[model samples]
Target: MELNHMTEKSLIRYDVKETTKEKVIWTLVESLYEQGYITSKDEYFETVLAREKVSATGMEAGLAIPHGKSSAVKKAGFAVARLSNPIDDWESIDPNNKVELVFLLAIPEGEAGSTHLNLLAELSTRLMDKEYYSRLMAAENSEQFIAALDQVSVKEKEDKDTYEKTILAVTACAAGIAHTYMAAEALEQAGKEKGIRVLTEKQGANGLEDEHTATMIQEADAVIFATDISPKGKERFQGLPYIQVRVAEPLGKGDELIDRVLNNPDGIVSAENDTESARGSENQPANKKTGVLAEMGQAILTGISYMIPVIVAAGLMMGIAKLGAVPFGLVNEINDISYATHDNELFVILHHLDKFGFMIFQFMYPIFAAFTAYALADRVGIVSGFIGGLFAAGIHYRFWGIEEGIPSGFFGALILGLSAGYIARFLNQKIKLNKNFQAMKPMLIIPAISVLSIFLLNFYIVDPVFGGLNVLLRNTIEASQESGEIVLSTIIAAATAFDLGGPINKAAGAIAIGLAADEIFPLTARVLAIVIPPIGLGLATVLDKYVVGRRVFDANLRVTGNTSILLGFIAISEGAIPFMLRNPIITIPINIIGAILGAVTAVLLGAVQWLPLPAFWGWPLVENIWAYLIGLLVGTLFIALANIFIRHMLIKRGRMTITS
Candidate 1:
């Protein structure tokens, strides 16, 4: 866990050309790649870049720790480069200093926040001492640098308790790299100068160092927390007198903060009355605009994060059940599962499985909304948020079946989830209570009030607005069918793929069904819309490397993509619903465009699906079957290629990140 144990002479390089900031990082990561420390250079490089976007890793002196924790990392290791020229563009804690010593850490996702803190602690202790840094920089070669690191303990020479008072200190930063150690050293140095002993714990990127035990905490006079982030294990310091400030505060004003804490104690942070905690009160008002936007985005991502497993499970089960029954000619192809025929036992079982899957799939929106609210307002907001999601799913039109209902869909879920969270959070904060009555806030008051608010919001506003929207869309698509072929095809494709089986999709389907019954128009666009998104997304997973020259989808998403392609062929679009829910901004537009391109191509080429057959097996019955095949290929390829290229560009530009 220590620095000496994790690194060796091979990792130490000197006299590197520092042409630019990126070149220095590339050098270290390349060294790590050469040593089999990382699996993919691009992935690890992206991870390091992503961390830099969160906050700068450069410290007060010439030190920089590029903490890269990723699935691409094969081992927990580091490469050290002493640059020939200082890189001033590297954003350091102290703006005046430039970076020359770079430590590019390759840490596997599993090794983060645990084993690396010890290495940081040891290295930080030495780096804080100017004489040690001079000796380290004075090394002639990698061997001498390794030897200098191997010979340590100069910073820890003094007796354990050589001061008047003993206090506990914890330091942390947003990136949990350089500043945590810098602040820890600062507090310790300040303690020494004030004739006090400071036992500092660093909650660094890889782990906690010099951690406090219960015994040490019990005997301590007080605690000082210098952290930009909230310190871990804060419950342990429940009743202890403490002073909390930004992690960077200690680098210069450690003595002043120490004097204030020892001379005039700060307030207590107990399990009770958490609204008044220093962690919230001290940092909440820092930035209004940036904080709100970031928090909202994180809440949505959190919801999607929790909802992915549910959709994956349900969608795969339904797809497999339908596909399994296909060979026996027992699949409905329209309803996805055969209803009246239960002659074969296996077919009957598959039908039941399909039903099970469909039933589970329906909870995706509710779960997404509930968890999103949970992210924003904690446990108190879950009930109302879940109910709001059910409304979004159109399950709230209880007076009649889903055929007559008009759900607002994902947009509704977003508004209701955010509303429920803020309402619950506000109530929890403003509604003060005695201990006996406190339990009622979460259990009764917040849920009742929030759920009522959601009901009123949906009934009077969201549902009706979307219901009117669906009617308007149906009219427009119907009217468009009377116009030019291109206009009608575009309308049909866009509307059918817009919400992926939501109200707008169903509305388009209603018009298409009527037209087909009357034999008024070719159903080329209508049928293609049913399969394009699922098939396209699935093909994207397989063709990602062929198109973009690297794996764009992670291992899990690739599996989803395969399942989606399989389901799409059987006349199912639900397979790609998860993609839409997770990344709607990109996925929906692509789905619509791909469907439109393919449908319009088929329509122009005189490929006609007049009998409402859209499944792969029905292709032979279409007029100009060759054209239909070409259109299908065009649509699927476009979806695959677009997804791969767009995602790759975003990752390269450090705009989008793939989460494992």
Candidate 2:
């Protein structure tokens, strides 16, 4: 499809009166539907809204781009609304933006997505210029605006001289979204002006995109890699003359980058399966990150991404296994399913399935730490990360002569992952060898040094700090039990909600179970604490937009939050572990506060739970079920509200960025 033809007079609206974000979006989507660009308005509308909820599409100034990628889109097209009045409440990267124009794109589900992204990239490139932006905003009618957009779409690349040389480019970002393609477009456009054919391979969230075939690589004169993450199949570019730059660099310095590659010849990369050469700019160092906090957050987020599939699989399996009890009217927890293994065939099948879920659950820390380290130090960090994670999970602590060891939890994993990543990265840079022996660096030297460092750190540093804290918290829980029901409930609830399934949580459970077994303290507070965080965080995901006037969690998180709500009913607090791991500073305190509030409320209202059952099936066994429900509601609301407001403040202050 022609780029200019994507939008015509029919798809463009001028001086629209829609003042609300929803109304503007609906009006634009309806136009696309009427023009035969989409199959169904409802389907496309929901998809667009779903994308919006993931993260707002608002750019800088007065522009927003809300889009939907679905099979419901008949054609890759867009509907533009140049609003008569600004939409004040529209969520944007620039929080103070008064949105006056919106480009609502309907993207088809498959290969057409590349073309769709290219169009947006071109638009972004054009709008980046102040004069071009002003001219578009000053356009009196849709015709003028369409003409302005068409100038770049149809003529920008096609205007270049006939090509004699060929170049290949790879572009990527940390989020793997718009910037990846935008940089690709910039390089391609720059190469066009230089009379060179630039074929861009986008290594992004969509996976390896574009065809950089064997024939194409053989014929290429040079390669340009503008990436925040590692490009896939980079081995294919071995011995190729390549220039590496930050993902955002080519967007503005494309012409200069193209000139550098064409003029210079020392930048050969991947001879020893390493991409590093003398970097293009000494000012912009290789693997330079935004900041300490942002880099750490990005690594944790990468770990979380790898861990999500593990979580979803385990959550579903365990949740289904729990539901197996409903038909039998059993009053048993997840662990007791094995006790009934011989009693019934159905119970036997569920017992193994539940065990399988637990088995998969155990890999979370290792996978998380491995990927987190991978993000920072590449493959060299994997060994140290895995070993560190074992310590974090308390799997190998028995080697220290402790039979019952405390798991160091997510914080431990984070510290170790960072330590390993930086250590590996530092060593990789510092350790030098000749060309013949350099291959051993990634395989032998780095791994040996990294693992030894990790062992020393885990043994001397990580375990003692986290393990000691857990022991102290456990003692505190036991001491508080003699004070009063309120005091005991608060302590039990706080500890249980502290780390979800970590050492402190286990410690709280141990003391609480001992007290309950002796009939000294009922199991009311401990049971309530188990499900409160997951359910509360889930509720917060749904209610955050309404509370703070914008979405705090991204799309992936929203899905996790929904699953967490389902898992919470079956008494799985691990569903909310991602939230705590993602933002412990905010999520932990709120979790403790919420759990304490709920536990105290339930105790004060006479909700006594003496039985060991804590899942949904156990509610009937409680002494005052209504009080339990009321307490749950109060705590959930407090958690939801507190997280929303606090996170909103953090986002506004630029302390956090909600990635798509």
Candidate 3:
């Protein structure tokens, strides 16, 4: 079999008249079908529309390339349409006077794999030049536009054959959007101008999106790291020739990226042209702190990884165990699950297993949190801080007026671990010993100082913090009680929904976990609030498939939303991020409303339970099991019903389509 390669001259078109987005799309599809570029206009358009439903292909600027690959394509081809006017396609970019150019792309199903990605990358590279794109928009005739495109297409292929030296680059952003991709393209363009090869990767909220082979990265002569966000793939880039830049700086002065990469030290910690050059004096500062943070982060990840499976298994098992322990004839509640029912031997056995499971669950969070800190700071932090957390847990269990027992006391563990890590680092930096005794600092002096500091802090500082937090928790519950339970639920629910498992969501989650530990919130309430976000958002996305777009719905969002619920059971908050990011306008506010309604209403109604697990653990032990069930059911209904309404409007307005 053979293939026909598309050239620049074959891709140019000038007179496109459809002014609206849907009409423009249909017109283009019809044009391609008429030109014998596609097998069926209806089939190809349906495929493209389905993909678009998942996410827009409008990669900023005045450009949108709505495309799909299927067996229906007669040949690999592109239809460029310079839209007479900008059209609204529910894109992320500005709608006013924007997106004047639309590129309709198609390729046969067999050719849609790597070749499609290469073409997309090629198109993206050309779009990176604002000046060049502006010129393309200004072209008065088809011939002029073809000439400009020919230049780009010819220049790209010629550079491919030349011997190119590989350079490593990293692009990151605080938001992990907008500037990350832009910076990557800018650096690649700059390297090409200097006749250098480049392989760049990005780290974002989605974690590492691109993973380059170890061999390719190792082969690079120099590296450029442009970032505001934390770069996680550092271990892989170790000992490489590297220069670091902020993401924005590269985009603003892209031409300088190659120069900076070429001039950087072959193998170094800090860049050669550092602004703090004066600090590199003859008597270089001793006790240089390098890799400490990286090491700590690794430890934390390890602890969390080990703890997650424990939490899920124990929490779920305990929830079912609690059900068996429920007393049928008692007016007063029994703290012990085995005491809740004395008649049924089966219930008694499950209750006993629940006790054991609860104990295991208790250690999951704190142990992992302490370990995480240990990984960051080393043995000094692991020993001292984890001990402090245990002390905090003990204090909570004995004196903080906890009724349900502080099984895990996660907050205590977290504080203890952090304190130990920092105290050790501080002592290591400050204490000066004889040169002969310096070797013992990390093993002896550092640990000794850290443990002492942690012990004292736990007895005095952490205990006081715990006292204050306990009072605050009591006061918050009482105040919400006075104001109606809905208020409390609303606040927590809003936090959970705001960022879709980000900082705000985590804040709400930590609160729920803390309450569950104290037996203030029923095991069921916490589960309902936690689980509803992902389940509701996931449902909303499914119902409003058309408006939400098909590509996103099919490719990335479904997995993200569905998997988030699974993660939620392990107390991870970020699982609902895909739907939130994809349909922020509709999903964000609705999610907040639903969560709050569930939380506040359940609280106001006096839905309380004493369970050994968090709502994040899902089902089973929800506080006032009925309240949890009702809240989740209601929230799901609200989101689904609302999405249906929104979907109808979108379809009626032609924002969503059923036809090609």
Best by TM-score: 1
Residue range 108-199, candidate 2, lDDT tens digits:
65543466556654565565555667877888887788777744423443532467888899887654545666678778878776778888
**Sliding window of 10 residues with minimal summed lDDT for model 2:** 152-161
Estimate the TM-score for candidate 1.
0.82
Considering only N, C-alpha and C atoms within 3 Å, which residue pairs clash in candidate 2?
A: none
Clashes of 3: 33
Clashing pairs in 1: 113-206, 114-206
Superposed Cα deviation of residue 40, candidate 1 (Å): 5.0
Off by over 4 Å in 2: 2-140, 144-165, 173-186, 192-197, 203-207, 218-221, 227-235, 246-248, 262-268, 271-276, 279-289, 329-343, 398-402, 546-549
The parts of candidate 3 lying over 4 Å away from their true place are 1-119, 125-166, 171-189, 192-221, 227-229, 239-241, 246-255, 262-311, 319-360, 367-459, 468-660
Overall lDDT per candidate, in order of appearance: 0.76, 0.78, 0.56
lDDT of 1 by residue, 252-349 (tens): 67888788678655555443323434344544322222467567766777787677677778877877787786686655542444543756677667
lDDT of 3 by residue, 113-188 (tens): 3554344445545667777677677787766776565355334453544646777777765434335566787777
- Global lDDT of model 1: 0.76
